[model samples]
Target: MLTLPGYLVHIRKRGGYRKRFGTRFGRGMDIPVKRAGARRIWIQAVSLGEMLAIEPLLKALASDERIEIYLTVTTSTGYALALEKYSELAVGISYFPIDFYPFSSRVWDRIEPDIAICAETELWPEHTHQAVKRGIPFLLVNGRLSDRSFKRAMKLRGFFRTVLLNTAQVYACSELDRDRYVALGAPSERVVTTGNIKVDVAIEPVLDPVTCSSMRAEMGISDGFLLLGSSTWPGEEEMLIDAFRAVREHDDRARLMIVPRHAERRHEIEAMLRERASDLAFHFKSRGLPERELDILIADTHGELRALTQLADLAFIGKSLPPHTEGQTPVECGVLGKAMVFGSGMSNFRSIREGLLQYGAAREVSDEAEAIATILDLSQDPAKRGKMGEGGKAWHASCKGAVERTVKGVLSWLDR
Candidate 1:
């Protein structure tokens, strides 16, 4: 189906056809084949977030002299990140195949993995079936099943049950996730809750005072409250701008920085900002820090979200505000000890949201009105903000060691 003229034409128009088709068509052989008698393991992570979550595990595995690691990603962004961050550690990195019988079979024959591991929710039927037929152990690490995905999988229970039964093991993110997998027909004994590896994301060292001061000066801000709208989706940006406008009514020094989920959407967001709030001065991060103080900053660059999080006094996570959007992860902001607020649509990270709320680390707002009110309230109460920040840091610290546990689990399987 992917080779159909219509599909080929569509993909070509979208661009990056070479990177997307290189693996499936057997075009890119940048990484040489493994040597004979080498112990090889193939690990697949679907995108940037999954790749990040598996970083520590990859590092741990890199120390073993006997094992050769091959990494694959489904998206161009993931493939780039895997290479950029893990090229030295990985023996081979490439785009995962399209999961068609021929494509998967060809890719598998080349990798010839002793064991195959799928990160997160990547359950490719053809790929898993081929591995099972070859007597290879197929495992799912950091497994999760959201309510929306559970309903969809239930519709194909018979098909998924057969696939799940053939799998060797599933290390889920939470007990709830494990239960959902069992309900969907995975053998209960094969699934275990191993907690979230995101909790173990490496924290960069604190920026020196000189660097922080220079960054602030470059941004044209001396003393101001920075509100960051991190990884926002469509519709949520407008709501954040509206809330920021309301926030400025009380304190003109309040500035808003927005980082859209997709950097390519900056033009659309810029147009909206112009049409809706032309009065506010806004600049893009790609353009060196504003010469003068600005009301809004658009972070259109990649790989700076973590660094930017350090500049924010308070953060509002995106995707949650729009009723239809399920929301992005706030774990990064939470780990930095930033006081955060999100909307009602957080089913994708329900466990994380609940944990933050339970620890007084974050707040949930229902709409623009509540979002505005909460941002204003948090801005006014320095003590409250401080408490929230400390609470978040404590919570983040408590969730550590999942990476170690997950690595140990994977090693045990290899030994068996």
Candidate 2:
């Protein structure tokens, strides 16, 4: 197959990424390097979550004197997080060269990796083809195939078949996902069911009532109020506005906490929330809030929401409430020791969320009325809420080690 001018394609890909996700994940920058040793392992993760999934592997490989891991990401956000979180293990963070022929060739020559591992379903044709052309064994680790994405991929069988075959080994997230890969032309022998690596998050229970109370107080949430948290994605705020209002009619004074997926969207979401709840004041806005009349408090920042789960009397995680994204966040309100409410549209994070629900840690509902009622029910019963939180923490702890398994896969490729 023919390709476009390498420089022009590179320029366009860079510009487009800058325009759409540049602010969120910066233009992938090629870091200036001075290393006498060559990278034996080139690990490419597109962004933050993908980058995160590979941390265990990097840690595991750091011990090998023969191996050098070169980490690369497509977004600035991923780069920043990698530098911040995995600086000790990641040898170098560079922009993944945009997939144009000669540019990719230049990248491969510069790094001169013996092996390359890409996380998830990111199968860039140019990159893999070059790796194959140069005889560098390539592997896809932690591959997932949601029914929706797999069906669409099957449509492009002609396009993806060669690329699939290029992968030396496939570490799928599940057996069902493995079958999906097999259908997509991945050799069954190369496919192995490696459980999803997201389960490796260090989710220890943090019991800081004083700090939790202060955060809630700063956000204008009074005692005995429900905290509905909307994590990442668009369109979730609108869903929760109606959801919260419905809860208020029954509870009189309900508190809502919204944390958008992107921190930059906070101002936009705050503007919308202010118009809807004109009387409410929030800490983010710095407006004087009545201790009692405050209904909704927008969490316009990051890093604290996961910890703030402890303050929710009864919680509703936002992304799941709306169809903006495929699945809901499964906010782990239960992780904070509370049976929080979710929506019927828990298409995202289905398996993990289902596990929480099966353990009686989370409960899902159809609409605002049902969600509100569930929160209120949990609020009225302390025993039930405490039990749910305990269950969630238990389940979260039980599911650790995704990172270890992923690390093993990355190391195994060194032999090939």
Best by TM-score: 1
CA-only RMSD, every prediction: 2.2, 4.7
Model 1 Cα lDDT, one tens digit per residue, 217-242: 68765458888898988888888888
Which 10 consecutive residues of model 1 have the lowest summed lDDT?
7-16
lDDT of 2 by residue, 1-416 (tens): 25436544654543434433322222443444535664478888986657655655676777777677788877655766777877777566676776767667777877778888898878989888988899988888878865567778989997778998888888887777788888999889988887766655544457587887776666567555665665645665766677566656666766777766566666687677678767655545334444543566666544455566666776766655544335545634544556676776665466667778878888877665676567667756778877887888787777667667776776766655
Candidate number with greatest lDDT: 1
CA lDDT of 54 in candidate 2? Answer: 64
Q: Please, what is the whole-model Cα lDDT of each candidate in the order they appear?
A: 0.83, 0.68
Regions of candidate 1 where Cα sits further than 4 Å from its true position: 2-15, 35-37, 220-222, 287-291
Output the TM-score of candidate 2: 0.81
Candidate 1 yields a Cα-based lDDT of 0.83
